[model samples]
Target: MEFGAVSDEMEVKAPAAEAWKVYSTLQLAKLVVEMRPDLVEKFEVVEGDGGVGTILKLSFPASTPVFTYSKEKFTVVDEEKRVKEAEVIEGGYLNLGFTLFRVRFEIIEKDEITCITKTTIEYEVKEESAANASFVSTQTFVEIMNAVATYLTTKQL
Candidate 1:
């Protein structure tokens, strides 16, 4: 099995604390759904207390270019560091040939009113599924960050 990882970083216009609140809670999904329902048809907490063990079931609309749905569980949450990690334990990624798919979101505090969002994706794709894995785009994180930043900036007004 071959392992590969991709990382994307975005400078947010809001404070680290504000960005942390958005990234560390379920609010992030809500923002995504509100801002881009076409990309996410549904977002629900299937289990857990919205913590490290929390399970989220995400459904994608038929117009979505990627997976139709995914079941992910929070594997790590470090509030002090403003970091959260989730693993796609079931759903489309697995069906598309990925043996493992995990995403890590880190909000770095640069100052009182600025921060950077670092998104990392680690995956292991089976040899037979390698051809299908090329469609995975890291730019999705950038788009999400832009949307969240816009939301936070407007909320502060």
Candidate 2:
């Protein structure tokens, strides 16, 4: 039933800021862009403070089989814990079934040298959209998480 949401969590041996830098970098978008290279032609810069209001156009490839969206607006930026996030909202067509589906990555420090990144996705699929059979949501999420793990483990930052 949870075909729309793919989430994973990973622990890192680096400071939050260290890992944050990589995730916050503009290059990070390319990882996801590989899945939908046609969708995100590039990053749309906004706010200018390296925060908020940035949007990416996600596009599907011409050679793909499934009729998927070429673009979805996923984002990376600093956010306060428990403080409601206003930017980087998701929904529209990936709406699952409801008008308010969302995906988010939250990072928290466990200590001076440890941090955990939690990926949360809320997908409210209606009966019409819930009829799909093959599902790789969780696996996709795990892959994303592993990417972060790999990035964080590459160095002892």
**TM-score top scorer:** 1
The candidate scoring highest on lDDT is: 1
Runs of candidate 2 with Cα error greater than 4 angstroms are: 1-7, 31-50, 60-70, 74-78, 82-98, 133-136
Candidate lDDT values, in order:
0.88, 0.52
Candidate 2: C-alpha lDDT: 0.52
lDDT, residue 135, candidate 1: 60
lDDT (Cα, 0-100) at 77 in candidate 1: 90
lDDT by residue for model 2 over 1-157, one digit each (tens)?
3345556677877777666665565455665564334433334433343344455444445553444442344344554451112222443344334433455666678888788877666555556666542332455445655666676677554
Q: TM-scores across all candidates? A: 0.95, 0.62
Task: For residue 48, give model 1's deviation from the true position in Å.
Answer: 1.4
For candidate 2, what's the RMSD? 5.0
